[model samples]
Target: MASRAPGEPDYQRLAFRYEPMAGRGERRPVIVVGAGPVGLAAAIDLARQGVPVLLIDDDDKLSQGSRAICFAKRTLEIFDRLGCGQRMVEKGVTWNRGKVFVRDEEVYAFDLLPEGGHRRPAFVNLQQYYVEGFLLDCALALPAIDIRWRHRLTGISQDENGVTIEVETPEGTQSLACDWLIAADGARSATRKALGLVSSGRTFRDRFLIADVRMEADFPAERWFWFDPPFHPNRSVLLHQQPDQVWRVDFQLGWEADPIEEQKPEKVMPRLRALLGEAAEFELEWVSVYTFSCLRLDRFRHGRVLFAGDSAHGVSPFGARGANSGIQDAENLAWKLGLVVKGLAPETLLDSYDAERVEAADENILASTRSTDFITPKSEASRDFRDAALDLARDCPFARRLVNSGRLSVPSTYRTSPLTTADRDAFAGPLEPGAPVPDAPIRIGGREGWFLDEVGGAFTLIVFAGQGALPDTDALRPDPLPLDRIVVTPPGQDGDPPLHARAVEDREGLLARRFDAAPGTVYLLRPDQHVCARWRSFDAAAVAAALQRAAGGEIGRC
Candidate 1:
């Protein structure tokens, strides 16, 4: 493989081996379409779970521009599980503070990671190309994943048991079959179109021009959003620093503005010059005009075919919801698909993917819609309200709460998910069922590590055994899917080692505080690391029932 140039990606064409498929009619267990971040993430995750994945993409190159630059902490953790988080964090620019401006006056500023002691930062700004490259490398390194570039999904059809897809390769067209299909084919999804699926939602009239420029500057690594700035009169603008001396600038253009003309060098140069001033020398790397919509499919799961990422739902970029949510969708779906493929869980478990992710999509759409509405008010009354909020936010702290300059991406809690085993006992903290496991510093045999790192990517039963012996494995489920058990003891417990091999000491009492842990509290965590159930005391029958419920089985609650 050839190395990529400074700003250009090397488009390496991968070999297609459909001839062998023709000789032996074999249906792969999983087929992931599209090679973008979401598709790559799903493929990598499935491969990690010991599932063989066939990843197909229409293109052989990375994304052209710095698209979807903001990556949330949760997404980074998912990347960490996928084996590429360290590289992304090292190569991306980390920013937690964001300053909102009304004209030239700074009104309000906020910090995403207000508290300390986190493994990952609040967010990172890396170009979409870099993300895809890292994900592609991770996928290639995994033996279970076979990536076929230039393999376009031209047709798709599914029945009760499997899906048959037609691919258009450089050589010719070929047909392939799969027991499961994951459509991560992006916003203009060819697979979605072939399946005759259409997304329904509101498309905003507002437009935005994104310009990626390369320049040596001393701008702080922070998000700067201007509402009616003097540089660009009435429209809103956003600026952020990226890696490699590159910067992203977004200019809000009204509905009537011509996108083609706005993208021209003549039109873009003046705006860039006004923003950066005449003395600043900068080279334009990429420019594009875009209009976003908050749209989603009626259902993410259709029989044997499933949709993930932009193929299932899309939100405006203001909140960084686009790629971040897509990556999460991949993570959420991967574990369920893995369990189903292994026959450890019922097929009905897959239905929870749609039920939970649709709720998440609605949330992202709502947040993005509100941000768009605030940034570009459609009515005079709305503009008056927005201006009032901004004006008062300059002085009063209460008014700052009203300002919504894109509610930066955060993982959605699947509170109402069917997979969640409802909490029957009273709990004090936020480590509830369906919520992602909170990260905390823990001491394991004199070494420090994150709590999430120890309990993720498997069905884990975390026993807060404060000076108590760990629960015996014989008491738990006899033999289901592999369940990892970790015993977290209180600080300075000199008790004998527990039954489980993995044990940690909550030296700072962070886990105790975050989880409201008692001497015998137990938490049942899903493979994706979301809390499925918790109890004040360990009950083998309850834990077994919850595990069955988490895996889409009918059972009585304790």
Candidate 2:
């Protein structure tokens, strides 16, 4: 059965109940404040790792409009780990290539995922409500998660041990305590406000109108962006296809445009008719005007209260960076917080979440800021530069690289992360320490699968073997921490049985070529599927030491 209709969602207000134990001062393990995609994803990730979580949200309904309609490949892969990727990809509109135009003329085209062997597409256009609904279903099914709707966080304070929060429930105000508090409440975070922390960054003066229209159209399943089109004279426009005969259209209205007036049907219809032609027939499903800013807190962790998603940072919607990066924040924070809460790693391990994610947030901010400036030129000189670049891009290949129709979102690389053990072996291609591992095709036990499927949820050692016995992992795994292994053999190797680690035959040599692998080449991956360390040959001692360092233990080298 479908969750909601194609045009707009029927808002469902979930019931609210008072849990006596929450206010009775019994300390809980983890409490996540917010039920958006980021909060739900965080709660689910922690729960899957055997950590009980209490997820609270101030409101009872899913997000209203088609806000955040784009989900990137990295975000989908993270969803796969959360056990909801298949449903999302099956329901959302998938696309990989997009075209750019200048004054109704095509300037250049780009392909985000030009190569194959990946599980999910480069981008999926689904409404934020659908994303939230799917994630909520996942959270409810996990026995470790307790979701409380209409539980607003009114006050928060933290000490060296844990955080104490005051929540406003249906019955009355209540007090709760937890070992850690995750604030995913969104851009205007009550938790951040209560703590007196501020996010510092720049805010653009331009505005954009989002019109979700329901119509039968022939637009291809691809991103089509225009700079100074004929219909909308000097301004930019963006078009995207969503599931269920709905389309998302974005028109750039200048800073002086009145937000209320622009959202009216009379004002919006003229613009739509101009683009779709006067003869077209359609119904306006949803309409809104928005102004965005790029900002983030100086530190994601304040005492025992941690922040993720919009509560921690926010960016312009141009690049689809806000939600994608926020979900990633949950991924980065979950494993570290899980280890810290379980006492398997020291509390200091949580600090790396700040160090690594802050680096990523800063990178995203820089990219988003640049895209905004290019799309909306602040000065005549800037517009001239952009126009010239667009004109030259039609012919010169080098100028095409300069044309920025909002450089689409991609996963951030944590090259400066403190948890990464610097590369000691010479390597080629882009799979380096602190980089997210790329996926390839493989066959294991007479079944085909992707490379990433065999390498998540724990610290993993991927050993590239060549038609030989599977490498023994007896000495590689350390005490109290389970390390998984995937032994990749040559393409034609037959499946073997009774091995300590799972073995896969590189079905097309894609895995070998992607990882720059050779006989006995070893890669050490963190729980979040990031490469922490690698070597030309499998050295049990080096891999063990690197694994320990990645878990926030003392840094060791071999």
Query: Which whole-number lDDT from 0 to 100 does residue 122 have in model 1?
Result: 93
TM for every model, in the order presented, reads 0.95, 0.96
Provide the global lDDT of candidate 2 against the true structure. 0.87
lDDT of each: 0.87, 0.87
How many steric overlaps does candidate 2 have?
0
Q: After superposition, how far is residue 102 of candidate 1 from its true place, in Å?
A: 0.6
For residues 1-558, could you state the per-residue lDDT of candidate 1 as single tens digits?
Answer: 112346554423323243223322679999999989999999999999999999888876767677889999999999988999998999899999999988899888999998766789999999898899889889889999987878889998888889999998878888989999999999999999999999999888899999998888888999999988988998899999888788999999889999999999999989999999999888898899999888999999999999999999989899899999999999999999999999988888888899899999999999999998898787889999998998898889898888888999999888988888888999986577899987888888778788877877889988887654566755775376888988887887633555554788887788888898888998999888899999999899999988888887852221
Which model scores highest in TM-score? 2
Tens-digit per-residue lDDT, 200-298, candidate 2: 888888999999998889999999999889999889999999877889999999999999999999999999999999998898888999998889999
lDDT of 2 at 146: 88
